[model samples]
Target: MTSDRARLREENEALRHQVATLRQELTCLEEQMSFLVNLCVASHRLHETADRRELLGILREILNNIVGSEELGIFELDAKRSVLSLVDSMGIDPAGFQSIALGAGVIGHTALTGKTFIAGDGAAPTGTGLEPGLTACIPLRCFGGDVWGVIAIFGMLPQKPALKPQDRELFALLERQAGLVLAMTRPD
Candidate 1:
């Protein structure tokens, strides 16, 4: 009887472990689902309007409400000189970053390479602007993968501590979809 009881206890423990693992996986799936929903909503809002100001407003909302960044700038690339000029920003003055040359700093390099540069991910050379608090530079690329601009996030909201995996997904969504709206709404 004791041996049978021991076997049952071992089995119970194994079952519990499996249950715990499954629970963790379920939580991850739920999180992913929520992220997807948010991305869809953001994309829809971005394309819902053809007005440049309205699109910019939606972009800011995504950066602030979803990505948790309060200080950010939308830069337009001047490809002739390989420069990125700040078009709009919130929560911080953007005078210093009005123009940034490609490969000159984090933001410029992110635009040039069409890569997202998150601070602390690596030793990214910082020099263009918004130093001491520059958090991320996300290159906004259209379907062809040509980077047309950049989203420079200088600071995040107080409630959030750091960027998460979901934030990266959102950045990617913005990189792919956000640029299209601007391109479509381009002025003649």
Candidate 2:
């Protein structure tokens, strides 16, 4: 049997080593968690902004930054008719496509279902009248759960890796921001 003093010293050393290992792991996890939290906070700030045009611009920037897509749009919903009309957009010409109907095409399906749809299977283009590739339509809801609009994102050539979960998430973020911005700008 070992002496009591030696046994205690060994046990103490083992415990100290364990604590140090735990501390290192905790520090690493904390740093990772901090990064994730910062991402969420930044996204929220972008979504909750009150400036309409600024919010649209920021939405475009965020979508472009995250998904690296060149074509994006925000289509306003005609509540009475439940149609989506072009309010603003980027990378696509809006002058000829405004007043397009919702629930009449792909954008309509995405807005009506309130979900994301993949369009890479040679699916024909929808309301925007643009050529379609891998496109994502995100529902935009305004105050009191009113469906205000949608942020439609598309690419002409198929994206490598096709579609991704991150792409959907980024589209959703763009949708939320677009709704907030549209509400502030549209006439009451």
Candidate 3:
């Protein structure tokens, strides 16, 4: 009878451990779902913006509230001049990055190659023009495989010290959706 009680106690403990693990997994899933929903909302807001200023504000909102970053710059590519001209920026000096040549720094490299660059990933080449604390550079590509601009993301919030899988997903969403929105709204 004593052995039976010990076995039952062990089973109860195992079941309790399993329940705790399952609860943790559920919590993680909920967080991811919330992030995805926010991404969708941000995309919708970008599409609904009527002008460049509104678009910039929406971009700022996404970076600040979603990505947890406040330092960002949006540079439009001028193919005729082969230069990236800053369209809007925050938390960084605009004069220093007013016009970046194609393939010059992180912004230029992304504009030239249509490749996203993330700092500390060991993928950015030396002198890539990544600012002192910047973390990611994403090429804004419109439909038909054309890159129209670049979004330079500086430091993440202290709470978000490093990039996560969700952050990468958000970047991808911005790369695709933000480009389309900008292309549609850009003046001819």
Candidate 4:
């Protein structure tokens, strides 16, 4: 009878451990689902927006609330001139680094190659003037395969110390949706 009782207690403890692990997995899934839903809603809103000002506001919200970054800049690309002109920015001053030439720096390289430039991946291009805190440069490419602009993310929020797959997904979404919206809203 004593041995049987000990075995029962051990089995009960194992079952409790399993339950706790399952609860943690469930919580992670729920958070992922919530992020996805918010992203979808933001994408829909971007598609529905017609005004350039309102679109910029929505972009700001996505950068701040969704991607968890406060310092960022959006630069519009002029292919003919091979230049990137700052159109909007937040948590960073846009005075000296307003315009970047193609192949000039990190932002310029991303603008030219249409590939992301992660800060920690390597040293930033010479003379890019990327702030010490800058972490990533995401090129905004339109659906037509043209690089429309670049979004320079300075740093992640303290709570988000490292970049995740979902963060990259959000960058891709911005590359497509924001590019299309900016192209549509550009004044001829």
Q: What is the C-alpha RMSD of each candidate to the true structure, in Å?
A: 2.4, 6.7, 1.5, 1.6
Q: In terms of TM-score, which candidate is stronger, 1 or 4?
A: 4
Q: Report the C-alpha displacement of residue 145, candidate 1, in angstroms.
A: 2.9
Residues 93-174 of candidate 4: C-alpha lDDT, one tens digit per residue: 8895788888787788888888887766766666454556777888887767789999888878899877777878888888
**lDDT at residue 142 of model 1 (Cα atoms):** 73
The TM-score between candidate 2 and the true structure equals 0.65
Q: What local distance difference test score does each model get?
A: 0.87, 0.68, 0.87, 0.84
Ranking by TM-score: 3, 4, 1, 2
lDDT of 3 by residue, 1-188 (tens): 99999999999999999999999999999998899799889888988867978998999889888888888899989989999998888888888888999889777888999988888777675564446776899999888979999999987889988878788888998898888888787888
Which candidate number would show the highest TM-score if scored against the true structure? 3
Off by over 4 Å in 3: 128-130
Look at candidate 2 and tell me the lDDT of residue 22: 100
Candidate 2, number of clashes: 1
TM-score of each: 0.84, 0.65, 0.94, 0.93
Q: How accurate is candidate 3 locally (lDDT)?
A: 0.87
Stretches off by above 4 angstroms in model 2 are 1-42, 120-131, 156-161, 175-177
lDDT of 1 at 90: 95
Q: Is 1 or 2 the stronger prediction by TM-score?
A: 1
